[model samples]
Target: MDHQQLLSLLRQMTLDEKVAQLLQLATPFFKGADDAGMITGPMASLGVTEREVRNAGSVLGLSGAQQVIDIQTNHLKHNRLGIPLLVMSDIVHGFKTIFPIPLAIGCSWDMALAERSAEIAAREAAVSGVHVTYAPMVDLVRDPRWGRVMESTGEDPYLNNLFARAFVRGFQGQDLAGDTDRVAACVKHFAAYGAAEAGRDYNTVDLSERLLREFYLPAYKAALDEGCEMVMTSFNTIDGIPASGNAWLMRKLLREEWGFDGILISDWGAVKELIPHGVAEDEAEAAYKAIRAGVDIEMMTPCYVHHLAELVRSGRVDERLVDEAVLRILQLKSKLGLFERPLRGADPEREREIVFCEAHRSSARELAVKSCVLLQNDNEVLPLAGTGKIALIGPFAQSGDILGAWSWQGAKEDAVTLRDGLAAAGLDASRLIVAEGCGVDAPATEAQLAAAIEAAGEADAVVLALGEHAWMSGEASCRADIRLPEAQLALIAALKPLGKPTVAVLFNGRPLDLHGVADQVDAVLEAWFPGSAGGAAVADLLLGKASPSGRLAMSFPHAVGQVPVYYNAYNTGRPNVPTAPDHYVSKYLDIPNEPRYPFGYGLGYTTFAYEAPRLSAAELRADGELTVSVRVTNAGRRTGEETVQLYVRDVAGDVVRPVKELKDYRKLVLAPGESAEVSFTITEPQLRYYHADLTFASDPGEFIVYVGPNSRDTAEARFRLTSTV
Candidate 1:
């Protein structure tokens, strides 16, 4: 429908009907649901009625062909205006055919693959009757203690922005209005949710406007720039006001300044949370502030449904506010072409055929291969020969915890175990000995340890599959001590005495402190929760069918004390130089300031040597560009992939700047003796940053350019920028 038609429909809606249109409920509230469910418990608690459920504009956390079809058919029968219900789910990583976690995907540094993952996820979800996915979580993160870090790309604003754009593109394809295979993308945790204090979930976030705009806001803006259709408000506050009720953030900045004209939904129950946030005195006030601040949909709560209509009837709230919110909801359904095809893309047979098909699994396997980072491979101990008598021992040897969090629809029973992967690759049973050394978090039994030792004693080498269970890391799963459990570490220590080549393959969701494990194992592979074909990808990489190319997106600290450790940080006034004696400097007494493995750090089967960067020009004008080129040669015997990272430092700026900031990067594949020249064109606009007063521009001065394998180790060159005017 056009604007006038939508407006006409909105004008015809009664106040209660218009108010109900802004409320989102789950499947259990309605008739014809999968099960015979009722709306008593939650609705009675919040004073919402069955009539409101019938008039709800959307559904949350419910999908499946017949269920969606039944719900929609049942809903339209009672809805006065016959408005269709939008079906939305947290399809964060994948729907059924699970892929690597978002953090692992960021490690791949392959934006095309990341985009393809989202595309496949959309394909699977669309057939399952999902209309929108709350994904492309673009919040920039430096603290891994926040469990949602697994959902974000990483800490670097530039890299996270790139991945955010890719995810939005993949989720909402070019023709979202006409494509049944695509779903509307929703950028989440709007503003700075990742900067939760003390690495706690939903904790308070405090930052200056300059710092927030500089670091946290870029990725969200990038997703919006890529035309993402929806936005979800974060649970935390901006300037002491909850985002769901902050008019300055949602109205002034996002709606007016950024020009985002899409639906803005609250996080689960976040609209009602304003009461507990101490901003609103009661549920009625929560609803009043949320709508006035521009939250179009209230998910899983009755604050909006119970109070909105009354507020509008009274002199306190405006009826046009309710009308505007309902109009956006209508426009979203229209944009999705729901009026024409209410059951858009919902096909039970198609869902069964394509959910976990071989082609989709193959793409998942390839991506998992690129996502496994070889954190340590001392003396070239990896790429195990298939001929050796290998012992696969640990909790994850035959465990099915490979599918990480947010993979609710994924079939854990279908996961390929490590033993299954080895056998499927034609490794004879006689050559592979397997044992369950210990549980992920539970203490190991004496018999289990004895069995593992006996198996390792007879094998030529040992591969210990270790990690956190899928439940340990995700939303509300933050840990104060981000390390493997003691039982798993004991298994590592027990295996170290066998005098055999040992490899520890970790399947986790966040960066862990590997103090005991890395030192004890000959090799450490950070195979983050590698999705469905995780075991197969591990087998391929271990046997040299594929090489490890993944790098760290988030830093792994030496200890949890360094919670916010990252590569791009300011050089403090009293810098802690490694060579200089530690005195009156910003150095820890118990540990170092540097991360155990810095951002962009990874090890492959091969090595690369970098030459000094060559600059095309010594000075760059505001209107011109500066080209930087460098030569990289594979110094090792094996063929592998390397990500050449580009970083820049402002010698002097209007304000303090990070010592090194990631600007651009290129991934390369080289033969044993081959060399390649990679170049990047740096423009003046790329150097612009927000100043103290919030003015965005560049300060003309000397800049140092560095290009190499990772952030820590790089070769440097110099260039200067001069304003054209």
Candidate 2:
């Protein structure tokens, strides 16, 4: 059906039916036809009637084609108009063949690989009967204390925007109207949920409109402009109003100004949360406020079902709101070709053939390899030679917690262990010794410690695999202290006495403080929850079968006190100088202002040399573009990949500006001692930033251009922008 046909369908729906289109329930609610207890179990707790269930527009957290077929068939039998249900899931990283977390993937600095990961995820999900995925969470994050930072690309809006567009293109494809393998993409936690105060989850957000427009809003806008089909409202309040019911954020800014006509949904239970947020009086008021704010769908909430119809009929809520929302949902279904084929893309045979296939796993392995950042490799202890006994210690040495969180369909049992990868890489098993040094966060007994000491003493070198448990870093899992658990630190401290050329392979979700590990270990390999193929990826990097190419998207702090440290931070009025710790500056007496490892910082077997940048013109016209060029050379004997980053700093602005902001980047694959000259074309639009009044424009002033492998240690040149207008 087309737009007019959808409008006609809306005209035929009863007020209750129209209201029900805004409601989404879980998979259990749809099993009532076969399981009689669903009515008394999930339905009772949900406070939804059987009539609402039949009329409900969508379902969440449901997988498998056969189950979707059964539920859709049963629903059509009960509904008057036979409208199909839109099935959505949290298929963030992968469906069955999981990839690295978004933060880890961002470290790869390869947008093409990022898109391929999303494409594989969407293909597996579409065949398994998922219609939409809440993915490409484009919130600009700086606080590592926020657990969901693992879901974001990084702290910079420019980088996050690139990822946002890529994920959307990968999920939706070029023509979602024709492709059954692609699912609709939903950019989530709309607006700045990432800037929660103290890095707490679902905490209130209060920022100037300037900062919101400049930093937090660009990635979301980029996703929507890239043809994302939906937007999920954040749980936090902005400008003292909950985002689910903030008209200025939803209707005025997202809809009226930005021209987004796609579906706007609430995060789970966020619509009814307006009451606790102290914005709504009751469920009826919540329904009125959400619809008024232009929210089209309410996930896991009955407020829309119980109160929307009554509110609309009583003239308290406009009926057009319901009609517009239902039409958008219908348009999505029609775009998916669901009206013609209600069981669209649901094929059990395809699901069996595609999910967890070798082709998908190969892609996952490739991404995981590129995503592992070699943080430290002093004395070149890695690429272990078959010379002597090697001891592999710690909890994750053989653990299968490689598939990180939000791998809804990924099998932990199938994940390749670090031991498995090392063996597969042709390591002599006779010379390899393995032991559980300690639990991830639990102290080992005296006997366990003694056994670990014996294993290390017998070995020539040691590899300690350590990290936070897989459960430590998804939604609502925020930690006030972002460091390794005491038990793991104790294990590190215990092993420090051996003085072996130790390599610590970390498997974590967020960038950690690395207090005991980084300082103690000879080499630190940040193998962030490497998903199904994580072990193989780590093995390849360690054994020099593949070079480590991943960079840091988010910064690793020197201490937990530097929770929100990032590369593109503002130059404070009283900037801290490393030479003057006692000066009256913005300095911490105990810790430095800089991060332990700055953004874009990573390592490989080979070293890189960056020449000073050269500008095309000393003075750039406001309407013209400026080209900055630099030659990067592989200075080591090993072949490697280098990500040449371009950054700019406005010397002065109307308001405060960041010390440096990422403008463009290039990733080059070079043979040993090869050289490549990379160039970036900087446009006036690229130089623009939001002022205090929230006007997006560029200033005619001096700008410094820096080119390097990472955010820090860059070679710089100067240029000036002149306005012709």
Candidate 3:
């Protein structure tokens, strides 16, 4: 049915029925029916009791396509209006076949993979009857200490924009309502949550308009351009106002300025927290403010369910607002074809047939191997060949804890443990010594210290896999200390004197303080939670069949105190002087303020050499575009891929730019002695900035462009922009 017809029918219904449209009830599972006593009742609340479920819409969680089929089948057969519920889940990565987290995948620097990952998520999600996903959290983060940085695609606007469009294409596909296995992607956190003060979750964000436009807004805009159907508000506050209630952001900017017509959903409990943000006086007031501000869906927050109707009945909120929200909700359902053959998409037998199928496992393995960023290698101890005895020491050495946070309902038994991978590598189980050197969080014991040293003694090379536990970093799992916990360092130090070549394989979600490990380990392989087949993937890289090409999405700080360290930071009045160590400069007293590992920092078994960046055209007119080119050659014996990053800095502008800003990047694969010319088209958008008047403008100025393997290693050239704007 058309939205007008659906709205007309909804309008004729009672107020209780209309109110029910706002409530999103939780379901148990598809295999069991609600009346079969499988469902306990409405999902347990953080605080509120189970409200009545009579006219409520439902959101599916942990339930597969079959459950969605059963739920929608029951809704059509029994409900008064036969309004099918919208099924949504947290499809952050690949749905059934888990891929790398957004941060790890971002290192691929491949827009195709970002889009492909999303498409796979959409395909799997649709197969299971999901219509929407709260994913592609386009919050540009600079803080490595903030645990959620693993969920974002790193800190640069240019890179994030490329990722944002790819994510949208993967999730929504060409047609949302028409596709059986595609779900609408929700571009999120409306404004600057990444700038949360002190690098703390839910902390207040205070930024200048110049900073906001320059660093943050581009990704969200990119998602909008890609036809994203929904947007989720952030939990944090911007300029002392809660994002869930910020009309200036949602109404004026999102809906009015950008012309976004999608449904707006609030983050969990964000609407009710307006009182703490000092915006609303009560829950009823919160309802009125958020509804007027253009939030169409209340995710996990009952404030909208219990109070919205009352606010609308009174003069506080316009009734048209309620109708508008309902209309959008119904339209999304219609697009999902939930109203029409709702049961056609779900097959119970097919559900059992395809979850974690071999195809998915293979894809997961490829993603895991590609996601491993080789941070540092000395004397080339890696590419472990020649069939020597290896000591795989550490808790993660045998761990199958590949499920990064917010994972779906899969058991540990289904996971491919690291032990499984080692066996597949044709290594003798008896010869490969194994020892739990220390726990993820506990201090090193004398026994663990002794065992690690003993294992190191008998091995040709020690592969020490060390990193944070599966739960150390993610949403609500934030940490004040980002260093390796437990006795990992002590254990590593003890094993260091064995005089054997040592390789460190880290299974972490976020970047860690690796200064100590860098000094001790001969080689470092950063295998961020590689999903189900992660173990096999790491083994493949270790055996040299696949070269590690992943780069650091976020910078690795030398110490926990340097929480928000990143590459595109501003140039201060006092910079590091080569000879003059200090007076009147932005220098740290104890240690150098440089990051332990810069963003885009990674290593390859082979090496590539890049000629200095050269501009195709010297002068750029306001309307004309020019291509900046660089030639890169693989200088080693083997084939390798290099992420050639392009950074631009405006020497003088209407408003100062970051000392360095990532404008463009290209990942190129070359064989030994093979060379390729890489180029990025420079346009006004890439050169524009938020002016002093709070408007985006392009100014003619001296510009510096750098192109190289990573942020720290680059060659620079200066050019003058003679744009006649």
Q: What TM-score goes with each of the models?
A: 0.99, 0.98, 0.95
Q: What local lDDT score does residue 99 receive in model 3, on the 0 to 100 scale?
A: 82
lDDT of each: 0.90, 0.90, 0.79
Which segments of candidate 3 are over 4 A away from where they belong? 28-52, 60-62, 444-446, 579-581
The sequence of per-residue lDDT tens digits that candidate 1 reaches over residues 1-725 is 77788888888888888888898887777777775456676666667788888888888888888888888888889988888999999998888889999999999999999999999999999999999999989888888888888888888999999999999999999986789999999999997999999989989999999899999999999999999999999999998998999999999999999999899999999988999899999989999999999999999888888888888788799887888788888998988989878999999999889888899999999899999999998877788975779999999999879989999788888888777888888787889999999999887899999999999999988999999989888899998888899999988888888899999999999999998998898999999999999999998888788899998898899998988999998888899988888689998998988999999999999999999999999999999999999999999999989999999998888889999999999999999989999999999988888887899999999999989888999999999898833
What would you estimate as the lDDT of candidate 2? 0.90
| Higher-ranked by TM-score: 2 or 3 | 2
Q: Lowest summed lDDT over 10 consecutive residues: which window, candidate 2?
A: 31-40
What is the model-wide C-alpha lDDT for candidate 1? 0.90
In candidate 1 the C-alpha lDDT for residue 49 amounts to: 81
Q: Which residue pairs does candidate 2 place in steric collision? A: none
lDDT of 3 at 255: 90
lDDT of 2 at 414: 95
